[model samples]
Target: MKLYYTPGACSLAVHIALCEAGLPFTLAKVDLATHTLAEAENGSTDFYAVSPRGYVPMLQLDDGSRHTEAASLLQYVADLAPAAALLPPAGTVARLEAVGWLTLVSTELHKVFSPWLWHKETAESTREACKAKVALRFAELDRHLATRDYLAGDRFGVADAYGFAIVNWATILRMPLNPYPALQAYLSRVAARPRVREALVAEGLARD
Candidate 1:
């Protein structure tokens, strides 16, 4: 499979999970500013041809089929590598609970940061409002992380991959994590994982 992504975007979640799962795949980097691939893996510079939504984390499978959406893709990758236990097995209560964590990461954290806080044209008041909202979510994460090393279960798993990608945005975007030491520590913990570190270095988000 070929995973199309923009460096340091939420797609990094899937990239890190794929690495941890020991999956074989290539990467196609998208220029989100242009929504074009520098070298299109699916034979089109126009990313819309490969993904009509013009989004990153579009996974083109070996059969030439494709999948999109990070939440769904995270679960898909987990199922493919069940031995890795990236996610709890499907159709179980454990799986449902884990999926709930992912949904919160997506709506509360990821959506809160994007389009508003990340865009310069957004009004200062709007950015402040978004940041305020994100802070509430951050506080919740800080409290939860205070008692656990990982978000989903006993080990670093799919939810950690997704949460790390979104929550690390606080660092990248210069939001203050100093007030949430537990969340900050959790970020550091996730970043130190070998596969997560490899993904980070590969995306140029960190030095090896």
Candidate 2:
């Protein structure tokens, strides 16, 4: 498969998931600023032609099929490698629980951080309100993480990968993570994973 992504975007979650699943794939870098794919790994730089929706995290399978959306892509990659245990067995409550965490992270966290925090033209008042809401959500995550090593059960899963991608935004957004020590520690633990570290370096987010 070939994954189209923007460095450090939510697509990072899918990238980490792929690595964790031991799936072999290539990456096509999407320059969101230009909506162009850099290095043209997939043969076309016109990201618009690749994805009409024009977002990163578009996974092109070997059979010429494509998958979009971060949460869905995360789950898809996990399902492809059941032995990796990136997700629990299908149709089980545990599986739903992990998937629910992915949805929550996507809606509750990822959506909150984007647009408002990412754009300079966003009104200061709007950014402040966004920050307040995110803090409340962070507190919820902090409480849950206090006694748990991962979002679902005790093993690193898709939700943890998705959560790390979104929650790590706190540092770049200058939002205070100091209030959420458990969440803060959670970030460290996720970052320390071998596969996660590999993804980070591949995307130039960290040193090799």
Candidate 3:
């Protein structure tokens, strides 16, 4: 499998999931600035060929099929390594709950950060609104994580991986996390994982 990614983007979650699952995969770095794959043998920048929308975290499977979207990719990696228990088993309430958390992280948290942080042309009002919404989501997550170790439950699953990737945006945006100690602690916990650290270092987001 080959996982196309942009360092520290939402694709970080998928990278972390693959590592946690102990799956063998190659990394293809995407230069978001140029919307091209860096160091391609053919020197092709036509990332749209792999993903219609030209997004990161596009997983090319061994059979040459492709999968996109961070949330779906997370579950796909989990399903591929069921023995690793990266996610709850299929057809169970726990699994649904895990999906719920993943959805929240994607739609509610991840989307909120992208516009304000990535797009310089965003209106000031829109940026402020996005920050406000992010704060509300963080507050809710802080409360939920107050007594729990992970998003889905006591286990460190895919939901936690996704959440960590989104919430870590606070650091990059220079947004204060002091108000949400639990959330801050949650980030610290996930960052300390060996597999997560490996993914971070591989992506050049962290020191080796």
lDDT of each: 0.90, 0.92, 0.91
Ranking by lDDT: 2, 3, 1
Question: Per-residue lDDT for 44-147 in model 3, tens only?
Answer: 66677557778888899999898889999999999999999988888999999999999999999998898676688999889899999999999999999999
- lDDT by residue for model 2 over 1-208, one digit each (tens)? 9999999999999999999999999988999999987876367778898899999889999998887999989989999999999999999999989999999999988998887899999999999998998999999999999999999979999999999999988888777899999999999999999999999999999999
Q: Where's the lowest-lDDT run of ten residues in candidate 1?
A: 40-49
Cα TM-score of candidate 1 = 0.95
Candidate 2 error regions (>4 Å): 41-44
All candidates: CA RMSD in angstroms?
1.4, 1.4, 1.2
Candidate 2 total steric clashes:
0
RMSD in angstroms, candidate 1?
1.4
The window of 10 residues in a row where model 3 has the poorest summed lDDT is: 40-49
What tens digits encode model 1's per-residue C-alpha lDDT throughout 1-208? Answer: 9999999998999999999999999998999898898895556798887789998888989998998999989989998999999988889998898999999988888888987878889999999989999999889988998998988756888889999999888887888889999999999999999999999898988898
Residue 87's lDDT in candidate 1: 85
